[model samples]
Target chain A: MTAVTLSEARPARLRVDGRLGQFALLVPALALVTIFFALPAIYMLRMSFNAHEGGQSYSEAWTFANYLRLLTEPIYLFSLGKTFLLALVTAAVTVVFAYIFALYLWLQRGWHKLVFLAIALCPLLISEISIIFGWWMFFPNNGVLSITLLQLGLIEDKISLMYTVFAAIVGLTYISLPFGIFILLSIFDGIDRRVLEAASDLGAPPLKTFAEVLFPLTRSGIVVAFSQAFVWTIGTYATPIALGPDSLWTIGLEIYQQMNTWRDWPFASALAMVLILLVLGSMALTRRLTGRDVTHHV
Target chain B: MVWPFSQSDLFRWLHAALVTLIVLFIAVPVAVTAVMSFNDASLIRFPIRAWSLRWYLDFFSSSQWTQALRNSLEIAAYTTLVSTVFGTIAAYAFTRLRFPLKGAFYFLVMLPLFMPGIVLGLGIAIAFGGVELFGLQLYGGKALVVVAHCLWAMPLTFMVMEATFKTFDERLVEAAYDLGGGPVRTFFEVTLPMVSTGVISGALFSFVISLNEFVMALFLTTRDTQTLPVLMWLSLRSAGTPRLAVAAVVLAAAVFLSLVLVMLWYARHVRKLR
Candidate 1:
């Protein structure tokens, strides 16, 4: 194909022009990105340098005070640490559940596939607020699960699962689960079923076959899914805020508080920059783990 | 077939049970939310006093709820249109171009997707605060909300369409050119049709993201133009009412309907591929 391309492909010059023309067609989009996306980000970076005092106008003086505050403040550092922990736990839970669910869907046939599809679609389809409310109902004192447990004598009294770290984790994991399942399902679909049969014929047990053959092939997918889930969970604001206890303020919630309650634009911008860096760092880490540029071994 | 002594069978069954439990865990919250929405009482309590469509009725009748719903729908529509158009164009450019700084430009475009919504909102809000263009304030309006949403939506749409375009056969474009078709003509007649599924799905995804978005909307929207999710958040903080449940149900219904439509579209596309 490479040898055929340069000489005989002279006729394909028209297609090359077609491709170039497609680039011209992108001018509007490029302009939009420049005006809205690039400009805003640049402006934000500039704003981070501006100096602000308590309830005062931002000055033109470039200062590192905001950055210094973020570094020095225990609250900010603590919130950032908590955000990472929550995201890590959420990613782990999502991957475990998604892997098992994807495996079941892959092994099952016919009607079971439809069942899996519906289950997978629920979290993806429902609004985040609704999901929160659902859990809110399930965890509260008079909520369904608590009430049911009490009635069935499974518990001595109503238990409040709401406003707990566990609830926050559950909510984040639930929200992230669908994307994990979808991406992993695509990976699972790419695997050759006969490989498992061959492994069994070679006297390999099912667990051994999974560990040796299937796991290696799906490693990239696992990395990608976990990273995506982690990044999403880290960025999440509503789930953590609504589900988490008052003590559990994430970086996202802190940013909101800074901007809205504190009216501290500079500090908020500093926090935002930190958030952007963390997200990019996580994405880079995921890419490294997955060896994203490498060819699939299978 | 008679593997009675094999541990694999037990493992398989365990896996199946685990999956079933996980599915149930995921579904229970949604089912509970739906049931609570129909509760007759004013508060969101369990072991329901009775069942009624009171919340749904209240949602429609209340100006606050209806207005928020309208704003949410309008913003979602605008965001979808803007993102879909710009994203498809950008996707085309990325997939087809070999321009200088192409990779850098693409990275810049997608950087916003990695930024958290809170950060994006804060940045935009601060960046545009008191900044007037054309004698009009840029912040705290519908226009700003749409633009803010496009930060993520555009990149998402681009990513999806770029993947679609990568799978596109170059030979077909060559064939079109050989038949004396211009690039624009070929794009409309051939390229668009080939990637219609991707475009539609991407647009739908943008719509859903914009519709369900809360964090950014919470920051940007004023009381007059608050989106549904923002209004819900505000209400949830101040008090827990059945009206909130009603809003949840309405939003859920909209999301579910859109999701089903998209899946049906995907099913038809898969059938066509077959």
Candidate 2:
């Protein structure tokens, strides 16, 4: 009877080994990523060098002309500069709001944090397109804000604020704030409260304690958060197109326009290549600044 | 210690005012959309002349809105299933396996998370468009939307689950295995129960992402299979109507509902930990 029981367990052991051996469970994801993500990225990089005209692909004539054009063209260079500026401003605004809100929640005891958390979730859960519509309805001449301001006599008449840089900044900051707060919250949770108390006990002012104690501890987290938000805001297309004025043409919008309207896949691919480089460069800088590898952290 | 009691009241008032202003700033736009959805006017304008559910009624009665909603739901459902399953498996492998190039694999898998959607959508469109596999075209259909969405959803799910798995205790798995359970039995009886919360949250996120995705859906879908966001985009460019507001309200409602569910789940999980 013992022998028979032992023999029965033998197949189970074999089955365990067999299952591990199959490695087939990961095939779907591996295959999907390899095809849809890996291959396409490579193809996009290659296409950036190719020459396409009039919706027709020519031979495999590889050149750096696309990159050259981007450097020489005033519009592309100006848009690149503006995109970086907008991303930087958005990151700064998000960080400030996120830091204050996170500190408030951290200081609070219970349900207050929940309320703030819910508010943070609002922009994150909704579509970017919908958030644009929401802000669009609240900013223009006939929207709620203008109407309210008009009623309260804050302005002479209904004012148009939709197509402004301020609108773009606000929208981007709103959307990116949740991620910043979430990341910083985790970092703040790791900090000990007694450090702040000790500083206070030493007669340090509130601002001094925050600067001298909390800031240094959360420096890496701040860097990570800022870089993440900057990269996201830079690459984002929808909010900028819907909320930004006609004069502001972000690289994202330019890429989209090249593909959809101009049917210039080569130029679009070149623009995408620049975006990819920017993202990679940011990732490298973040890793350097944080003094640790973040790939595993993800 | 200097308590600054003289200025405490002023500080408190300032904090209160700041919080209220920020909350209003965040809430007003959403509130505007919600209120505008009920406007009786065909045009979307402020100072409502009248209030009616006409837009909501129109949204539901109209075939375009209904079909788009249906398509969005179907695509989201499928994308959620595929991403959750694959993501869970990938997460498990990353957490459990001691394979070569593990870090590289993890980075590659998560790379899509940072990639811009426009680039991904364009690449997928060009790669899959007009490509027939055994007499079937994958692009310009719901299948393409599901695939394109997976590019975003899978990475997100993996990242969330990976974080959850890091905090998971491995001794429990060993204990289950030592108790005469096979790997499958151990996983089903021990591991699944442990990570079920993470799985649920991941699924919720994937659902929301697939539903709200616009750029990918715009590129990968046709008129018949266009998701709600794509439909909304087309409609917004073509005309402005209160019915669009109704659709926005509906989308926001769906997102709000899912968020509540996730928060409840998180609350329960916190309680369990306590």
Candidate 3:
């Protein structure tokens, strides 16, 4: 990780005495996370090793059977691939669109900017279930899309677009696009508007200026946005099930099925460990992508 | 891939068209949901045959829906309270006090933000399944849901409040101290008011997050303690009804209410604080 990335989230330092008092004050937050966050995670990791017998709870006969199964199991392995693929596609689409939106936002000094901001931020504020429900009404038979298309004479017959991978992609992209927009907008805010003007002044047209002067500067920032979106998208549990078909299973669904339905805690822990490792790896990649960008902190 | 339309009317027209298209794509589904909430149809289909208050009436009269709503409110209230207090104290430490291992603590505190909700939920469920505290088993209840929510809410609170305190003036604090006011008194009189907007904003965010959060709530709550989002998710998986649409509107309404509160605060308090 680079210092630039850290500085974005870092708190400003204030000089004061009584470091002891400060440490004392931090105890409640520390203890809150330690007991509820750290300890439970450790216990989960430990339970992944506990022996399982197709039971709801495992006994304390430490073994690597769950890990071995997670490695050798075809269902688990395939779900991991499917999850990574969907997440990559979703993140890529989200970042591309968000880049355009962010660029437009950076160029504008009008009410259009407020409209864009308000529209982009709505997804972040609403519940994920609500979003899934919205799209649920959107793609299914006689839903809004079909009704609108039918009324417009765009299609001869009423059609349902539900329970498809396309719906899954749309839902995932919708949820992720806001984060991408915010990240890339932060980068756009750092860019000097004069650079584009200079390119135009040098006899380059708009397309040439954008291609030569804008894309390269924003590429690493897009990488950070993409990585963050990918990491976030892979952890989604309800979107696919609610919007996509049953066959469109991801590892997130697998985790829920194992713990909630199948009652297999040990295997669920193994799956969760893999998930945590993947998220951390992607986060590290995000840090590395922006490591050398001088404009990163800005 | 730059287009050659730079000199043509097509360029500007297409740009405007594309922007409008994306806006509709983002807006239409939500509009459909809000419209469906009022649909009198038996199902969640569009082109409403007629509009009625039937679903809304059904939603209001149902004990299950009311119970879920109450549960959501209580859990969110608890989460907001606990997360805000701890997060504010932690923010003070991070912004105003120097200590060893502060960086490590920061990472540890923020680590849960990235942890998948399922993992967080599963971990707590397993670790605390057998927990006995003061002759009570702390599993599968509103209290567990509150604690689990803190994993997400506390870090959010800390991040926002920490940033807010950086803009706070230390001269005022020094002035209070110079006047012979002690730490607690200074904190209440001088420090608290300066950071009051941050506190309110953080608390509102925590509340909204808890209110809308269903991922961890999925694994944490029992049938009796299930939050509105959790109930909505459960119903969405099984029954795709307009009643669920009504529930979504309710949940979205809660968020909008808080959003209005924040906007009001921004108009009244935030500019003054600056």
Candidate 4:
């Protein structure tokens, strides 16, 4: 009777442990995301409606003044447009370059492949500040680009590209390029090389082969890469502020200025809400567009 | 063929030229910055008239810079520890367990990774920025930054470990359980040993993510608790100097050093098993 009771109690304990153990494992991660991630986002949403009293951080009052002001302000409107354009341009440029480079990376082997892989990983691994510094040193009057052009007798006077729209785009593109490459490369790796060989054997030109075979094959990947770059570029404040001219205002910069410089939490939270909306919209769009293709492919 | 070239040859030429340009665009700036760190001069001039480790020495010797570095490492260390332990367990549950709302849990875990750092930073700063727990102010503390960093680090670790565990053999786990070993013993002695690579990789990933992250840190940190990247961002805005380049190099070095150490340890571990 003791033996039977012991065996029955042991199984029941194990059954209880199984369910409890799973919850215990999941609880820490769940609590973290809820407290730090989800709660903060909800708080920001609520904070956006608060009024910033004069000479005060904020006072408890419900109003749409922050959002209304963001929409009505001409400077804010311009920044909204500029930020969208900058992100769009960055994403487009990054995807094109990344597609070509990823194709090149895929074709290499052995140590050659390793070298290319390292190059692609550098921008991803290095801090965004460091990348900005690298380019900051390259674009200024006394920087590498000017010096190189001068030594090459390409120009009589040194030209500074620092704090320009062009510089900002270059910096943004450089940083986002690696992500595009890595994403598309992984997709490209999935396709069989024999398909390409078959195309060439059928008397198709390289351009034709790419257009008909490679493009369609990697369409989902391209969309994913483009959206990734866009999302990343939109959220970025440092790259544009550090590398671009004063005229090159982005929503991210506006958010920073509102929060730190103006000491206006309500306005800052409003801008942040807009940024989050844009990111979410893009993500939703990507999911809708790629959902079918991804499922079909998988 | 049109214009004295076959289409394939033309494509090859264009591809080669583009590849070269892209490679240079990616590599040259970092290379220049690394070289500039060794410049003896104060300004960020390219054709260096002198070469010295003055900036490197300056970076290490300066109280503000050294303090920031210490803060970064300390925060990253804590972030790695918390993220790895929790992330691995969560990932194990994801792969091995059958529970309700499993898909929702996975989605919730990954949501933070996709959110903008600015949004995450601002939200946390506003929400818990001033909150005190047990008589300790949470604002401007390393603990806040660790939590913020874990938003990204934890998810990343979970994603990686989930993939690792997906490929893991359940039979090994079954064998351990069938033996006299209990659940806790089986997990520690059997499961953890098998997925050691994933655990190590996830730890390294979180470490690096936390080390380099500054967007969130910028919102959360006071001057005293500022990480190196945050300090660098502030200083870079105010001035241009070889010291900044030294900071970049130092950051890169930290990443490489850990990677090398991990590789060495992994190699030794494998040899011992052999």
Clashing pairs in 4: A163-A245
Weakest lDDT window of 10 consecutive positions for candidate 4 chain A? A289-298
Score candidate 3 by lDDT. 0.82
Question: In candidate 4, how many Å is residue B77 off?
Answer: 0.8
Candidate 4: C-alpha lDDT: 0.87
lDDT digits (tens) for residues A30-69 of candidate 2: 7778899889888888888877665564336698888898
Rank candidates by DockQ, best first: 4, 1, 3, 2
lDDT of 3 by residue, A90-193 (tens): 99989888887777677666696788899888888888888888888889777888888989999999899899989998998888888888888888888887
> How does candidate 1 fare on TM-score?
0.91
lDDT of candidates 1 onward, in order: 0.81, 0.81, 0.82, 0.87
Q: Which 10 consecutive positions of candidate 3 chain A have the poorest summed lDDT?
A: A8-17
* Cand. 3 TM to true fold: 0.92
Q: For residues B1-274, what per-residue lDDT tens digits would candidate 1 score against the true structure?
A: 2221134778767766887799789878878877778889877777897999878888899998899999999999999999998899778777877878876777777777767788778777776777888998877889989988988788888888988999999889878866878777888898898999899988998898899888888888899989999998888878878787778888977877877888898899889878
Candidates' interface RMSDs, in order? 3.5, 3.3, 3.8, 4.0
> Residues B27-78, candidate 3, lDDT per residue (tens digit)?
8768988888888989776678899889989999999999999999999999
Candidate 4 stretches greater than 4 Å from native: A1-13, A292-298, B1-7, B269-274
- Model 1, which residues run further than 4 Å from truth? A1-20, A293-298, B1-7, B178-180, B260-274
Q: Model 2 over residues B58-170: C-alpha lDDT tens digits?
A: 99999988999999989999999999988887787677667788778778888887888888888887677769877888888898889889988998888888888888998
Best by TM-score: 4
Error of 1 at A193 (Å): 2.1
Kindly report the docking quality category of candidate 4: medium
RMSD of each: 4.2, 3.2, 6.3, 3.2
